[model samples]
Target: MKNRAILIILSLLLFIIVTPSQAQTYQTGSYQTGVGIRMGNTGGISVKHFMDGRHAVEGILSARWGGIGVTGLMEWHKEAFRTEGLNFYYGFGGHLYLGRYQRYRRNYYYESRGAIGIDGILGLEYHLPRAPITGSLDWKPAINLIGRTGYHEGGLALTVRYTF
Candidate 1:
């Protein structure tokens, strides 16, 4: 019917008009690389590599409770507020933890079991105009899939990483 056709056309026009036209500005090239320590009892260094205007990958290496681990993350970001220099991102990643520990009192010990898990991250980042400095605060929650050990196995961490 003509009424149905008109409704569909109106909806498409509204969608196009309401959508924001903007792109995220990213620091690229070798000079844009950054290295900084993230805060928390489990401290780590974060490295970010921008693949394009809207995508990036990061790697983290940290030590906690005498264990060392590595994590890799991929994120998709969107420019918010249009040049307000703020970016919001969501990502999923995984990690590996390894170390050594004692098992029992009967002269028994074993290499600490390595752990693997998936994590979700939500964060906001700010970039200063004309400067190579960037800062971010993120909440990351991870679920242990391999070694189910303690209460601390699943929790949230607030992290800040400096980007060049």
Candidate 2:
């Protein structure tokens, strides 16, 4: 458990340090809606819909702490490092974490717990220009404000979707 957390933290740091910030390239989202799956510490069903070329809203429903968590985010997307089909995005949102069991493990406890929190997302996405597919790798962090209060360094996630 500790190893996984360490690895995740290191990976995030590496990406942040390495991503080039030169005036490279970017493209507006070509697809309007993408529905897919997310795999990570909070893996679940994911859906993203673009309101325009650069703005999008994403929703995630996942199982966490023996309960359910729903997250909604509003994001802005831009081209990344002159790479075609590659985009960099960042966003913020809120989440609801609901648990209904006495779960105690690894310095964590959630007994019928429900909390509200805010979240931030950072990542890169690649859309296939010739296919209706898209993939993204992102890091999400959250802080609970209502129930379980803490700064959660959200895990790294890979999301794949069918775009339309």
**Model 1: CA > 4 A from native:** 1-32, 100-112, 149-164
Candidate 2: tens digits of C-alpha lDDT, residues 1-67: 6457646655764675466644334445579899999999868999999887778999999997678
TM-score, each model? 0.67, 0.79
List, residue by residue over 1-164, the lDDT tens digit for candidate 1.
Answer: 54564355456446544666455344332234556667653458888777777678878899865778888888766765554567776676888888654456468655456778765566777776666676777766565577743223233344554565
Residue 156, candidate 1: Cα error in Å is 6.2
Once fitted onto the true fold, the runs of candidate 2 whose alpha carbons sit more than 4 angstroms away are 1-26, 101-112
How far off is residue 25 in model 1, in Å? Answer: 8.6
Best by TM-score: 2
